[model samples]
Every structure is written in structure tokens, then in C-alpha cells.
Target: MNTKLLFSIAMILSISIITLMCFLSPAHAKSSTSPNIVLIISDDAGYADFGFQGSKIIETPNIDAIAKSGVTFTRGYVSAPVCAPSRAGLLTGRYQQRFSFERNLTTKEDLNRGIAQSEKTMGDHFKALGYRTAAIGKWHLGNKDVYHPNNRGFDHFYGLLDGSRDYFKQVIKKPADKYKVLQRNGELLTETTGYVTDLLTNETIDFIERNKTQPFFAYVSYTAVHTPMHAQAHRLTAVPESVVDPKRRKLIAMTASLDDNIGRIIAKLDQLGLSENTLVVFLNDNGGALTNASINAPLRGYKGSTFEGAIRVPMVVKWPGHIKENSHYDQTVISLDLLPTLLAAANAKPIENTPTIDGKNLLPYLSGANASSPHESIFFKYHSGRAHIKGDWKWMTTKLKQADGSKKLFKFLFNLKNDPAEQNNLLNSHPEKVTELRLEWQDWFFDMPGIWTQL
Candidate 1:
């Protein structure tokens, strides 16, 4: 070979070797694993009640920061419109209905049934994968030992065991908040005369600090903006004089406190240099208060109903570098997606080899791996009735018929993608599609007898 040709070939070979070395580096390797998870679940938050969601009301900068840092779900939904069922789905990877969980939760009385250990939780999956798991705030899953957060794979927990409690006083006169002062595992924290948000935030920061060295799964559920709204005087006093109602201002104050708590946690992560290594997710358990009117506007209906406003919620997930920032996705994702999504990111496996969960891993769909939704057909059987989400079409109706086979015909079919307002009803126009969707729902109901609480 000529000397010039040999020299050129050698140079090309050197470039190829350097390129291969760069590809082999750990920094550029394909990753199936992700960062530590910080799932912050807010209680009874509204859909359009945040700054990022075109709301002129609540100023939620910390909430908006999660959206700006990663993807925001335009049509994010919860498993149920109420508290308990939504927690059931959020904690586990399947719809709450699938476990026969209905109603807003009651205490474990003589005959009351609690969340069974038969079904594993997201914490269990992470714990199995060697990640430190801790649950803080609002553990209404159950009151019994079998259903407690400690028994359900949480290494440490600090929060309520009941459904509702006062924020400042942390107790309602009607039902005593024994669950409020109750603490199990980890140090028992007394009511420090501080705000609930601040207390919860401090516990969350402590959990992160304790587990920062190793991968941790922190489930920081906040019982804020629920009812009997109470916040510090300074936070509420900051509101402008013009836009204020005594009761409404109280709600705003509570919301601001929640936002501030989130800000503290984010700041702690940054300060500890664990921000980039954390996959933070923020979402509301269910829709906001109905009669109290937490303001779920532009969407009809309210909490406890199977309407858009009842279950639709604001959702944001942030993971630096992996998930693109400032991205908004319109996919119909539900709260059940959280369990599997977290497990997939953590590379965790299920315990005792339980049956396949109802939720699909939404990581691919969220990270732009595929164009379609993780769920093509989602089911909702609230109480005892049924609802279906197939493609853009939403079909729902009563389970039983009246004496004349025309019972309370609560049927509504809407193409949510085009008419997100749910203004136009096409049940009469699309009887065929309704029939098809109904059959699919029937099959699902029979297959999963747990959809009904009695079953």
C-alpha cells in the first residue's frame, strides 16, 4: 500500500477506537435503571387550580416547577374520585375497584374489611429490589395490622391512619384524631405546634437525608387542602385584600402552605446534591372538595361523581436528563400507572409472584418511546356501577335496570380528545359503540369480581 493511504487508514482506525471507547463508558451506556423516587401526593387538589394550568387563583410555583422540569399530563386521572380508593390505586399498581375497594374509607370496625396483604403494594416492589421505603402522611389504606404501612413494606412511616383531620389543630370535634398523634416505626413525632405541611416536609427531608446514600422510595403523601382549612397567619395574611373570601382565603392559605412544603423538599434535594439523582413525581390523590368548592373549573361535575372534574387531577414527574423538561403530554394516564412506572424505573420485581397487575408501565409512553397511550382500554367501576375509556370515547352507564329494564339510565358517551369539556353527549348517536364498549366492560367486571365491594 502507498504511504499516504496507510497513514489515512491508521487515522481512521484511531478515530473508530476512540468512538467505541466513548460508547463503552458508563455515562453513555443504555440505562434500564433510574434515580431514587420521591413521590409527593397531595390531598384533594383540583385540575385547573395551579399556576401552570391556567389558574388565576392558587399560586403554585413549586408544583409548576415539577412540570417545567419534566412532563406534565394534560388529562391526568385518578383511580377514584374519592380519597381511600384513589390511595388504594396510587399505593398499588391496579385500580382500587379491582380490589373491591369502594367508598371514602371507614375504620376497621368489628366487620370492616381492610386492604388485604394478598395484594402487594408499590412499596413492597421497591423493598424487594433493595430500596429503602418510607411512607409519610395520610395512610388511610387500613387501620388493622395487616394493612398498616409497616406491614405493607414501608420501613418507616409518620402520618395519620384515618381518612381526614384538621390541618392546624389536626383534629375534628366530630371524630377524635387519635390517628393524628399516632406514630409507628421511626421516632414518634408529637404535634410540635407547627403547621402540618411544615411537619410533613421536615419528615420528608429527614427521610431523604437518611436514605440518600442508597436508593430510596419515599412516599410523601400530604394531607393538605382537605377541609377545616387552616394555615399560618403569615401565609394567609399575604393574600391581597381585593380577592378574598374568608373561607376561600383559608383554602388559598392551605394551598400556599402545601406549595411551600414542596419547595422545601425540592430545596433539600438540591442542597444535598441528590436533585439530579431523584425521580420526583407530584399528583393529587383525587379531585378537590365539591361543596367546599376547591375550584375544579372548565371541567364539569365534582368529587364523588364519575365526571371529568371528579377524577381528573394535575400530575407532573421530574427526572433530570432522562425525562425531557417543559414537556406536556395529552395521554390518558391514570394513578394506577404510578406503581408499575416506578417499579420499571427501579427495576423492581413483584413479591411472592403475584398475578400481573392491571396497570401497564407508562415509562415508555411518558419518555416518548411509543405514540399510543399505555392504556388503550381503562375501566372504572365506582361503588357498583361501571365506566369505560376506549380510545377517545368514554362510555358509562348503570349496572342494573329498573322493573321495565329501563333503570336509572345514566349513560354518557363523549369523545374526550376533541370535546374535553364533555359538553356533547353522543350516547344516542353511537349505540353500536356503546354496546361494544359495554360488552368489554361486562367481561372485565366478571373477570375481576373485586370491582364490587360486596363481591
Candidate 2:
């Protein structure tokens, strides 16, 4: 054989191998390194709680900085009005009910139920892109070994597995209480000390320092402003009794402490010079808890109800060069979009076996590349309550129990563009619009795999 012919064949084979390698690894195939992502999810924060959102009593300068640095989403929402289901939707980029996760899991139910193992999380997507992944605060998704954070593509995990925990030492009272303590990578930490917020913040800063040289994704899901409203004595004393109601003083202090830690997180990013290269997202798991004295004023309802105050939340995203500084995007966006959007930013390719996600890539609308809303409609269902929003029109249906032990169905329709508070019900007057939105909700609800959707 001719030597020239052999060399030609060798070069052809080498080129083919390189092309296949690129196709297999999309992350490394990109010309430039993708930015780091830091997702900060606060527990039960009200729509008007942040300083940037006109909170007169609670000062949140650091949380407000996120809005100042990038885009503040005035019409953001989560899939569910509660914790477990909402977190499931956010983490998996899909409607939780699509996989039988429609309601908050009880402590016993959590042992057997969670975000399914087949569902790939945002951490799984980022990990495929060669980015270090860590889940810092709350991990209410599940307590079983299969649903653990480490098993879900997170390289590091520091938090509790249950819905809530004590800020200081978590003493196991009942058998169910065993799932509520702090842990590092799934192992219980016996000597955990300090306030939960501060300790979590320290771990976050340390994680950033350790991985400053590489791209990473930090999911900081804080349990702040939640129940067991324990706050440091100093923070409580700082608030004057005359400025606000005595009942709300502790919640205010807890919120203040959370704000201070947020400041620490931002400062750490700046110190490591990772600010410009990092995409920071700050939002709430759901709406505020009215019983907790959270001020969700101007918006009706509270945390477990299907009202504007329960689903709609404050979302701020800061990406230095990509998103405009201090801009406000009024279009509706949901927690389901976070994974797809983050993976797109990371240049990560979707796997063939991964389940289909309901979220859209929000970059086009968020960056002005597209001028329309990210979604045409959003739907929610928890027990006997159901809600749907299309454009500016909103429809809600609830089952009220009567004194005779019977249930009554009440429907409401409101034009959110004009009445953001949902004060009036137009279901009778706008029968046509009511039928349209209700039909849409029925289609979505029935399509879900949960038991509640069986009918």
C-alpha cells in the first residue's frame, strides 16, 4: 500500500473521533466556559417583604441588591402553594403532579414518596456540564436514600431532610423527628452549632472559596422566616415594639438575619471575583404564611391557598453581562423554568432518556431576544382548589364546606392586569372567559398522573 494513502485514512479516522467526542460532551465542546449559577430560594417570603418591593418594616439591603444588579420579576410564580410540591417542580423543571407529587408530603409519606428517581434535577444537569453542585439549606424533597441530594447529582449537601428544623440544636422528639436534623452529604452532624442561617451561610462561602477556580451551581434553599420563628436576641431587640405589632417582631428579626447572610454571600462572590461570572437568582419557595405574620398585602390569600398571594412570588435574577441591571420584567414566569434556563446558560445538552419538562427556556424573553410572555397559561391544583391564569385573565375554583357537611363549589374570574388584588369575581359576567380557562385547567389537571387527577 502507498504510504500517502495510509496517512490519509489515519487523518480521516482521527477527525471522525474528535467529532463524536464533541457530540458526546456538549459542555466541553463550547468555546468558552459557562458562568457559575447561585440559586437562592427563601422559605415563605411575602411578595412585599423585600426592601426593593416597598417593605417599610423589614430592611433587606442585600436581598434588594439582587434586584438592583439584574432583572426583578414582578409576576413570578411556583407550581404549588406549598413546600414539597413546589420544590419538586423547581428542582425537576416539571409539574410535580406529572410524577404523582401534587401535595405536601407528610413525615411518614415522605419516607416512601418524593421527586422520583427517574426525574433528573437541575443539579444533575449542571453536574453533566462539569460544574460542581451543592444544595445548602432546606431539602424538603425527601428523606429516603434514593431521593437524597447526593444521589440526585449534587456533589455536596449540607441541610435537613424534613420540611423544617430548629435554628439551633435539633432534638429528635418522636420517631419522625429523626429526619429533621442537620446533615453533611446525608450523614447526621452531631455537633452542629450556631444559628442555622449563619452556619449555612458559612458553608456556602466556604463552598464558593473551594470551587472558585471552576464553574459551580449552588442551590441555597433557606428555611428562614418559617415556623418555630426563632430569632437571635440581638435581632429581636433591634426591632422596636412601636414600629410593628408585637406578634410580628420575631418574624421581622428572622428576616433581618436572613438579609444579613445574603449580604455575606454577595460579598464572598465579590471577594473571589466571581460576581461578574456568576448568575445569582433569589426567590421564594411559595407565597408568605399569613399566620406567621408575613405581610403579603395587596395580594389576597396566603401560603396553602390558590390565590395570587399564595402562588405569585418575588423573583430576582442577576447575570452581570446578560441581564440588564435593575430592570423589571412583568411577564409571567414560573419556578419550572429555572432548570431549563440554567442548563441553557451552562451550555448543557439534554439527555435522551430524561423525562420531558413543562418549563420553557426563559432566556429569549428575559434577554429581550423575544418580546412575548414565557408562558400562555399557568395552572395549579391542591386538593379541592384549582386556579388558572391566561394572559391577564385569572380563574379560580374552590370547594367550601357547608354546615350540613356538604361541599359547595365557588368559581371566580378576575382580570389581574386591572385588579391585582383579585377583589371582584366576574365568573357570572364573563361566562365565556370562565369556560375557556376552566376547560384549559381541566385538560391540564386530568393529564396529570396523581390520584387527585384520576377523575
Count of clashing pairs, candidate 2: 0
lDDT of 2 by residue, 335-374 (tens): 9998888878876656557889889888889878999899
Q: Model 1, residue 396: displacement in angstroms? A: 1.9
lDDT of 2: 0.87
TM-score of 1: 0.86
Model 1: per-residue lDDT, tens digit, 1-455?
Answer: 99999999999999999999866643233222447889999888777778888878789998899899999988788888788888888887876656677666653351255565567887887777667889988888776566778888899888877766666654435543465554656334554456777878888899989877777889998988787677689977887676567877777788888898899999999998988888999998887776454888788676777777778898999889878899998878888888877777765556676656877777888777887877878887676546788889888754444788774747888888888778898999999999989899888777565433431
Q: Pairs clashing in candidate 1?
A: 402-407
- Tell how far residue 170 is off in model 2, in angstroms: 1.8
Model 1 alpha-carbon miss at residue 379, Å: 1.1
Candidate 1 lDDT: 0.77
